[model samples]
Structures are given as structure tokens and as C-alpha cells.
Target: MSVSHETRDGVAIVTLQNPPVNGLGLATRRGLVEALAHALADASVEAIVVTGGARAFSGGADIRELNRPESGMEPTLPTVIAAFENSSKPVVAAIEGLALGGGLELALGMHHRVAGSRAQIGLPEVKLGLLPGAGGTQRLPRAVGLETAVNMIISGAPVAAGKLAQSRLFDRVVDTDVVQAAIEVAKEAAASGELHKVRDWTVEHPEAAVFLASARTAVAAASAHYPAPLRCLDAIEAAVNLPFDQGIETERAAFADLIQTPESKALRHAFFSERAAGKIADVGADVAVREVKQVGVVGAGTMGAGISMNFLNAGIPVTLLETSQDALDRGLATIRRNYEGSAKKGKLTAEQVEQRMGLLTPTLEYADLKHADLIVEAVFEEYSVKESVFSQLDAVARPGAILASNTSTLDVDRIAAFTGRPQDVLGLHFFSPANVMKLLEVVRGKATAKDVLATVMALSKKIGKTAVVSGVCDGFIGNRMIEQYSRQAGFLLDEGALPQQIDRAMEAFGFAMGPFRMGDLAGNDIGWAIRKRRYVEKPHMTYSKTADLLCELGRYGQKTGAGWYDYRPGDRTAHPSQLVNELIERHSTDIGLVRRAISDGEIVERLVYALVNEGAQLLQEDIASKASDIDIVYLAGYGFPVWRGGPMFYADTVGLDKVVAAMRRYGKGHEGAAWEPAPLLLQLAEAGRTFNP
Candidate 1:
């Protein structure tokens, strides 16, 4: 029963009973139509009050229905909205909690809207790279002003109902039970004999032409990589110039076109992939998740400070440990600076900043962490350092406490060996600036307990992170795959591709920054050390010596004012360095290779396919269970553009057979061994199947 029916006074209550934010899916859409019909037929019911419980009126269409029969289910959202507009009895929406995307559109479709003061409303389909298709663009502008509606639609952020209550969007906004308020509004509308529809209202704007023209310019510049926001504005523009019916036609047409777009498909893939990464197949709901009341972080560096902020922001007390008092003070100062920066931006108040900082307890001893339910070591990326930290943690931490290492590429299994309780040891690899980054790779060691895995995954949600479970491997999931992408980038440089050229190509493909730019930002010295280690361990592996030559000349990166690109003392902008370009040329000559012009297509194909190929191999090796999990790692941590999805999803988008063909073409050119498709990749390509499906 997706919808439950009851009568209050002379009003019929058609409550959307779908739990967890009544999503407008197949069952719910059919149920809504049936409930409305029943209400309209009943002579006893004077008016109709539609609602979806207090927790959420609706979050939108169930995304689980995407690309399925359920997505275009019978009694579609359009059909349901039409029913509300044509209803003989007055229909009023009782909106509360979240009325986002399709949920907000459903509310606009009713005769009138009666919302709770706290209700958050917005059309957020643009987040999934699509515009609202169910008459929202036509109706919302007629209710709220064009500027407000356009902003809401494009940004996909919600506004409190109280703020928009003065507008025609809401008939009434009450703090007391929204359903009761809606019933009263419905009765009044019925008494007046006016089923006031949102569509009937005209959109009024004084300078619509000037505003839209300027908006088009601004959005075009800001959303060059993303097509949805600009498309969203076009649909909204129709609401201003065109009639209600015409606007709807425009909206639906735009939605249809956008839905088929690769960008939209990619965004949808990323949305689903992020959620999929949280669910570990082996860890069932029956596995007990430990309550992490107090947290301990065993370092006072940048990573340690950032990790501590996550717990502090979540209102959980944290004990931050460092060897020296000066280091502890520096870490505490860094945390305050971050919080104060937020305060300056009006994201936090002075009181809230102090409140969060007050929760931090700086310590010089491990004994202070005995009562902590979870302890993370964010020290250094060395085996000896981790052994020292874990051994001390094993001695001092409570019996059931989860001990985690924040190692980017170190072996988690060996780190677990340093501790007596191997089951408690796992890797909680947070990217740099741990608090801000959403990806938390939960590396499960051979001895890692299911409960330990489940607890960390559950805790990740509380702290606002997408936790993906990874089987123990060097570089884990994101770093491991990125290693290949970086290798291709270096090889591209060795083959005469300039730093900016490769970066521009990747940027055009929707990467935030190319490997060289990222390396410069993250410090080229870090990769130099990793490559140095890999060169010793993997003697037969091929690598371009251009980066090594640059490092040897003592050019680190932004920290040293130069690396692949030069930077001004205070600015982060990457200016091309002739010194590095000359080094790349010399290295190409030294390798006995003829330097040639490389196309942007070649750069993107080589780098992204490198990821796709390695991801397939990881799947075959059982390092990753699902393809979507690999996508999530790149999407969340590695700055893979949301519009391109992750490497695997993007490969699926390009057709695996085509991807394989392109890889073979590149293999014939350079690094043929690296370009050889993985067994799983070849199998899927030959079968004319995708990595995801």
C-alpha cells in the first residue's frame, strides 16, 4: 500500500505511505492516482489533503527505478499531476521534511500548497543532470518569482517553506502539524468552490529579457563542463515567455533530450555508484555496528588535523595525539584556522566555532585514548612508523576499539601484524584534507572482523563520508588505479606532450586537474618518492625519467615555486616552465624515441583506459567486488568529473568494444605491454557487454 486513505472532518487524506521519503515510483504513482480518484468519487469527502509523512513529503522519484520499466511506470508522474489539476475536489499539498526534485514538482501540481514552516522545497533534478519533467518549470515560476525559481532549479538547493510562504507557492505555512493545516486549507478551498491551480497563475517579471540574457552568459561560463544547468535555465526561460502548456512542452522536451545525454547518464551513474559503494556484500545488517562515542587520532599533521575535524563537526569528542607539544599546538591551530575560515564565510558563527574546537583534547600520551571506541593513526606513510604507532595503540586501546591506519599505500595486513588484536586493525585511508573529502577507503585485512568493517561503514555515514570497502592491496582502490592513470600521463610527457596540453585535454574531458597539475599541487616530491620505491621493487616496470630529472634539479612543486609548472609566491596558478619542457624533450631523446604531435583524444583515451583496464584486472583479482565500487573511488576521491562518471562507467558509456579497439591502437604506438587489455576487459568487450551491466 503506497498510499493510505482516511477522512478528517469533511476532507479526505490521501497520505503517501511510502516510507523513507515517499519516492514517486511505479507503485506510488499508481497508488496516488487511485487514492485521488477514490477521494473525488466519495460524496462525503468535501476536499482532499495529500501528504507523505512528517519525516519527508517526498525526496523525488525513486532513483532505483532509473533505466528500468519502473522509471516510466504506468500512472506516470505527469499523469498523476494532471489528475490533481483536474480533480473536482480541491487538492492541497501538505509538504514537510524534504520536497525535492519530483517531490516539489508533485506539490506544484496540486490545486494549492499548504506546507509546514520547516519544510524544505526545491526542484533538484539538475543534480542528476536533468530538469524537472512533470510541469515544475511551468508551475514554479508562476508561484515563486522567476529569479528565485531559476536559482532553486539550477542550484538544486532547498529553501524553507516559511521563506516562500508569502509567495503564491504556498496557500498556508504552519508550524503545527502540516497535515492538519492542509486539511483546513483544503476545506476552505472547497468552501470557496475554487480549485486554485498553480498553472493558472501567470509568471510576472519586470526585466526578464535582460536577466535571462545575462544569466545565460554567466551560466555558460560557470557550467562549461556541465550541460544540465544551462539546459535547466532554458526550460525555466520558457516559463517566463511561454504559456503554461507551452512551458510544460518545453520542459518535457528538454528533459527528454537531457536524459539521453552522456552527461546525464554519467551523473546518474555517479549518484548510484556512491550509494552502492556503502553496501558491503559480506557485512549483513545482523553484524553489530559499534557506537563510536569518542575518537582518537594519533598524529598532529595536516591529515591528523583534518581527520579530527570530521569527528568534532559531528559533535563527537576527539583526543588528538602528537609527540611534541609544539606539533600538537600547530595541529590545534590548523583546526581553528579552518573553522574560523568557515566563520568568515558565514557558514559558522563564532560560538559554533568555539563549540567544535572545545570538543578537541590534545594529548602527548596514548593512555588518553583508552576509552576511545575508534582510534585512527594518521602519522606517516612508512612501515616502521605505523609499526610503532599500532604497537602502542594495541597496548593502550580498549579490547573492542577499532584501530585504523590512515596509510595511503602501505600494507594494512602487515600493520595489523604489529598489533595483538589483528581483527581491530584496518585501513581508514582518507584523502588529503580528510574532513572535506567524502571518500574513505575502508581497507579490510585478512583478519579484519565483519563487525569492525560494518561499524566503520556505519560511522562513515554519521561523519558524512562515502565509505567503500576495499580488500587489502597496495594503494588500496583509488590510489592503485590512479597509479596507472599517472603512468600514462608521464608517458605522454615523455612522448612530447606538454604539461598544459595534457592538463587541458584532461580538463576538457572533465577532470578538475590533469596528473601534472595535480602533482604540482600535491607536491611532485611525494610522487618522486613513490616512483623511487616502485623503481626499486618493480625493476622491469617502464617509467619516464623526465620527472626524476626535474626532482633531481631540486624542483619539488608549488612548495618549491616550480615543478612541471611555475607558480608565483602567493598564487596557485600553474605557469608553463620552459626548464621542465626542455627536460621532457631531452628525456624523450635519451629514450631513443622520436617526439611527435599527440592529439587530445589520444591523451584522454590513454589515461582513462589505463584506469578502466586496471579496474577490470582488480575485479578479476577480487580486489574490488563491483565495478560501481571502483567508479565511486574515482568519483569521490580522485576528482573524476561527475559528468563523465568514473573510469569504468565512462568506459561503459563509450562501448567496451570501442574502448578495446582504442586501447589496441594505442598499444601499437607506445607501451604496448601496459595497453594490453585485462582478461575481464577483453571478455566483456568480446561479448559486446559493459563493465557495469
Candidate 2:
């Protein structure tokens, strides 16, 4: 049974028993209803207390059941809540840990609520591009007034029980043994013969008409790309204007509409994809993870310092190594500056700044990292530099210590070959500004042990990273797919679209920044250097010379205040450059090509489909375990819009058939070979299947 029923001295206790967070799945809902019925029918039981154990009351609805037929199963959350409302026996909710989304809605159905002070409460379905569908919208305003309910629902952030205690949501706030206190409350309420229902309460807003009108305007502006937030406002407005039952009906109708929207579908896909990314195909729960108590970092450059901060923030001590005292001092200063900045912004306490800095041991010797549990080399991205560091680590490091390379694009297997114990060597490729970005590509070398991969994957969570396992490949998952995306962006520049036009189109499609703007911010010289290497290695690979020309003219990017677009000193905004525009026009004329008008639709399709095609290729090669894993890599790491899901999910939504057809059309263009659809994409398209399916 998902719920257990017991009684003591005429007080019945019903406990929700789902592990983790007691999600309101079909079985759990059925169990709750059955338990409630049993309590009401029992002769010995006069009052009832419904509680979830120390972990959670219920986190909400089961995400796995979303959009599935089983979501509409009998004894739905609304039906179960109605049963609570109509019960003869007083039902008091004893909430601990969390009561969120449908979980809080369930608690609101009870006659009274008593919560542990530490318990968190909210209706947070908006994060999943949804409103609280199970009467949360209609009932929350009645419990916590209109404005507070609107802010909570729209933001999808939780409030602590202690904070909401005076809001009348909970009848009593207890610091200890919430269930026992709730049982006492239930017994008293039963004796009083009075049941308090949230539905019987009226939502009072003095300036209802003016406030809701202003709120609708604010919501529309803040949620321009999303439909759910606007719908959420409408539901809240109904709560203020209509009667209780009418407001509930309006909320249900709005929720049903938002659930079917494309934006909601994409958001839901991202939600599940993040959870799915953590599971390894071969690694079992029983796999032993190496203890990463102490971390050592080589090369105290920008990447090294950022990488070291992740461990330090997690309260792990770090030993930072550099070639010279000056380099070590500079790196340490940068780390301190970063922490101080966070402290200034109220993100960290001043004591936390010193605490993290105190953990760092900066040195110029390789011997200091010998006893380290895990050593990460964030040296230059050159083979010789990586070889020297790994060889030195192999000589001095303890036998079982894990050796990790923070190389974004180097061959992990080749780097592992430098160490004596290949089983302990792997890649921990962190994205730029490592402490901020959540994506960590855990690249698995051929000889890498299951425990090592499992350890890093598990450790990623400790460091607050979303780790995606990748097989040994040229660029791993994110950078490899991004190479194609960048190539297409370059091709678009050479064709007809200018830098700003391309960036604007992509931004309109919901990307935080367009390719040209992103390239400028990331330093265009970085890609120029990568291309210089590729020019020698893969001579047949085609690319636009526009970026190279920009680099030739000493426009390296924001560091130089110029690249595809110009930047003023101290401002990161990209302003249109007449020199860059003339450079692009001159390049087009020099190449004997006529620049034609390119539609924004064509630009968006080409750029996004480029990623989709490359992702399908990665799937074909088995570099990525699943399609959703690729989505997680892009969504978390590459600034792929969460509202569009990952490239794979977006492609599926666009229909694989349409994507393949677009690819075939693009294949006939100038750089035709690059646009040729991946075999997997073609196969899926022919079979009328989706990448996610």
C-alpha cells in the first residue's frame, strides 16, 4: 500500500508512504482515497490526521504520468480532494519536509493544517510550464490572499512553513513532531464539531480591479514567450472575481489549455531530461564510488581557478598548482575576487569567502598533489602540455588516486595513455565560468573503470553540476554538436545574412544570444585557433573566411572590443560595426558570390537543424547513450532554450520528416556536404519516428 492507516485512542492517522517525495501518482491517489474511506467508516476513529513522513508530504503529481492516459485515472487529485472536503470526520494535515504543487493542494483540502517549522510549502507547477491543475489556483488565493498567491504561483518558488504560518495556511506551526501535534488538533476539532474549509473563505483584495489589470500587463510582459504565466494570471483573476466553484472551473479550463501548448511540452521535456541524464546505462547503484575528499588542480589559469571554486564551494579542500609563484599568486587572487564578488552580491557570506579561500593551498610543486584523492589538470589545450602534466601526476600521485583532465576537446583516451593506471583517468570537462554553468561532460575513456565514471557522475551532483556521460570523441557531446552549429552560423554569414540579422533571428527563437553575439562574448579568437588546427588536420572541411578575415584585422572579440560586432570599453553590448559590415560585403564580392536576401525563418531552420542533424550522428555513433542525454547536454551547457527543450526534443516536435526535408534542401547549397542528413535522421524520418521516441 502506498498509504498506511492506523488509529490510537479514537484518532486515526493516515500516512502517505511513497518514497522520495510522495508524488500523487494513480496508485498513491487510490491509496489515499481508500485510506480516507476506511478512517471515516471506522467506529473507533472520530478524527483523522493525514501525514507524510519526515521526507515529504507530496512533491506534487508524478511527472512520468504526465500527458499519459493514466493521468486521468479514477480518484484523481481533484476527486480525492473532494472526498476530503465531504468527509464527516475532521482531517488535519501534518506536513513535514515539503508540501508542494498538488501536495499543498491536498493539504489545503483538510479541515486544519499543522506543519513542522522547517517544512516548505508552495504550488510550483509553473516551473514545469504549468499552473497548479488540482485546484491550487482556485484554493491558494483563498488561503493566502490574491497577490501573494499570484506571486507564488507565477514564480513557482516555495515558502517555508514558519514564513507562511501567520498567513493562515497552517493552523499550527510546530518545531517538533508535527504529526502528533496534528493528531491533537484533529481530536480537538472533532470535539468542537466545526470543519474549516478553504473553499468557504473569500479572497479579499481592496483594489481588485486595478491590481489585476496591472498584474495582467506585468505577466504578459514578463512571460512574452510563454503562455502559461498569462493563463496563471487569468486563473488568479477568476479567484478574485468569481465564486469559489466557478473560479475552480475556470482554473481547470485554463490548466487544460496550457498543458497542450508547445511551450509546456518543451518545458516538461527539459524537466525529465535533466533527471534522465544522471543515469548511466552500465553503472549500477551498487558500483563503488571513489571518495573525493581532497581535490588537486593543475594550472591556476582562468579555467583552473573556476574549476577549483566548484570543489571549494562544496567545502572540499583544494591544492592549486602552477609553474611559477607569479602565476599561482594571480590565480589565487582571481579566486578570491570571484568569492568576494559573490559575497558583495549577498550570494555568499563574508565568512564564506574566507572559508572557501582558506581551503586553497597554492604551490609551485607537483609533489603537493601526491596524496590527493582526485587531481584535475586544467592546463593548456595542447597535447604536449597535457602529456607533461599527466606524466608528472602519474609519477607522484598515489596509486589509486583518480587523474582527471579538464580538457574540453582533447582525446581522453590519448591523455589516459600518459598515466600508468588508465582505469583511474577520465575527463571532467566543465563549461566556461565552471562555478556558474551547471553542465559537466564526464567523458569516459576506453580503459576508464566503471567506478571512476560512477564516482565523477555522483560527485557532479555534490558540486551542483548536471553530468552527462560521453564516450571518447573529438569534441565530446556539447562542443562536437556546437561545431556544426557554429559552422552553419558561419555559412549563413557567407550567404546573405549579416551578423546582427542572424543573432536577432535566433534570439527571436528564444536563444539567450545569437551565434555572432555569443562568439564575440566567448572570444572569436578561440574559434579561429581551433579552425587553424582543423585546417591542417581536416583539409576538406569547408568554412567561411569572414571570421578569419575579422581575426586578420585584429578583431579577436570582446577582449579586443571588436570581432563580428564592436563593443565599447566596459560594456558587453554588441553594437553594429560599419567596418565589419563592409568587411562582410567585400568578402562576398571577393569570393565572386552574389549576396541574396535570407529569410529569418530560413536562418532559424538552418542553424537549429544543423544541431539536430549532428545530434542524430552522435546517436548513430553511440557517443551519446540516449537522445534525451544530448538534450540535457545542450539545455544545461550550451544555452539551448529550455522552452524549446533540447535540440533532439525540438526536432521531434518539429517532426523528423520536416527536419530531414529541410536538411535535403540545405544539402544542395554551397557547403552541401555539411548539410547532408545523418543516416539515423534519414532513417527516422523515413520511418516516421522521432528522435525522442
- Count clashes in each candidate, considering only residues at least 3 apart in sequence or on different chains: 0, 0
Best by the TM-score measure = 2
Clashing pairs in 1: none
Candidate 2 global Cα RMSD: 1.1
- Model 1 TM: 0.98
lDDT of 2 by residue, 1-693 (tens): 899999988998899999889999999999999998898889999999999999998998897898888799888899999999888989999999999999999999888999999899998888888898878888888888888898899999998989887887889999979988998899899999998999889887899889888988898888887888888888888888889888899889998888888889999888888888888888989999989899999989999999999999999999999999999999999999999998999999999899999999998999999889999999989999999999999999998899999988889999999988999999999998887999999999999999998899889999999999998898999898889988998888778889999999999988888999889888888899899999999999989999899999989889999888888999988999999999888888888788989999999999999999989999999999999999999888888888898899999998999998888899898788998889999999999998886
- What are the root-mean-square deviations of the candidates from the true structure over C-alphas? 1.5, 1.1
Off by over 4 Å in 1: none
- Using lDDT, give the best candidate's number: 2
